[model samples]
Target: MKRIILASAFLSCASLSITSTAAPMDFDFSGTFTNDNDVVLLDFSVASDSTVTIFSSSWLSPDEGNGFDPILAIWDSSGNLIEEQDDGEVVGSTESNGVTYNHGTWDSYFTQFLVAGSYQASITQYDNFAVSTSLADGFERNGNPNFTFDENFGGATQALFNGVWDDSDPRTGAWEFHILNVDTASGPGPAPAPVPAPATLALFGLGLAGLGWRNRSKKA
Candidate 1:
């Protein structure tokens, strides 16, 4: 009974040691914005085995030359720069008979690399005077291209995106943003627990035999 209890305790502790450290962390952001062509930046902590995804959505712009271009940068948990995409025009633009449209509902994923805890996302309108009219209609020069930009960093930290525009000026429009945090649950990978070797078992058996023999001699 005593040996059974000891073995059970050892197994329980080993299992607990493995299971206790198997928790998944997550973050998510989503939303829409109106005429404020500006930069949106986000920062998140990155673990050695962490994965991250960013989702972006926006209503189609009315202006013909206006399109949404987003740039992202990532830093490791230790404040080291890990990855960065610095293209004034990261998203490809589509045009139909001289009408241009940018990609919306964009998503980017990061994994299998070391990244810093901080991330920055910046957005800029391709054309200065473009405006969003509808989803299907490409950006057309309305009156003035006061594009809107908003952001949700999607982690423990929350940031508010605010840009200044002149309401009195017909060229400027209101910039509104909404950020949503999503679920972050990671499935365990194929890493299996290491089993004890035959050599270790043999050593344990020898130790047990020695202990038993010593106990018998003491009893005699």
Candidate 2:
């Protein structure tokens, strides 16, 4: 997987900042992955009990142009991995963006209803996952050695994945993480998202561990 690395004024590791916005607003963090298994970590919070949606769609259509095969995840303030979604059946067809990233099933999507609190989110490539339950430890593929992938698709030995899957080459590009339906208070109020701190950005401890699932956005 060759990812074209681009330079931007934006620091790779962003600081967590918050903003208020109007209805149907989106909060996102952008970065890049230099190698396989590279992951981006972001900090965010929900003001109250409500439903939140997050997805990575740039890799799908030419719209954003760079978001790659994103894997979305979240953890509690304690750093415990809560949930990680691989494929989400989001856009059924192309909308105003005239983009249908939902077709690849490559984009990550998921929604959860929860109480307001601080949380950490992560964005990763195809199969790269969090090595431990804690966010501080980083991802399994973050520091992976230069090797080759094998039949052990999503096993503990995944650190051995050299980027390429069975036939699909590994890739690099813009790394983006987004949160939808954010609020400024305990209810639905719009807010601006903050960038993460230079922490080089760095979550799946497990859950979406395999290559297959039912009713996902699409299939490889």
Worst 10 residues of 1 by lDDT: 206-215
**Cα distance off (Å), candidate 1, residue 216:** 84
Candidate 1 residue lDDT tens string, 1-220 = 0010000001111221222123322222222224333323233223233444332222223331222333233333232334433232224444321333343322112232333222222222322211221111112222332422222111102122222222211221211111112111111111111111211111111100000001111000
Alpha-carbon error at 8 in model 1, in Å? 48
- Error at 35, model 2, angstroms: 1.9
Candidate 2 lDDT over residue span 1-220, tens digit each: 3222222212111333334332323454455555555445555556566687767655554545444566677766676777776766465433212222333456667777757666656666655666676655666655453223433332213333323233444344555445666532111111113332221221111111111122432222
Winning model by lDDT: 2
Off by over 4 Å in 2: 1-25, 63-67, 89-103, 145-170, 184-220
Cα RMSDs, all models:
27.2, 9.8
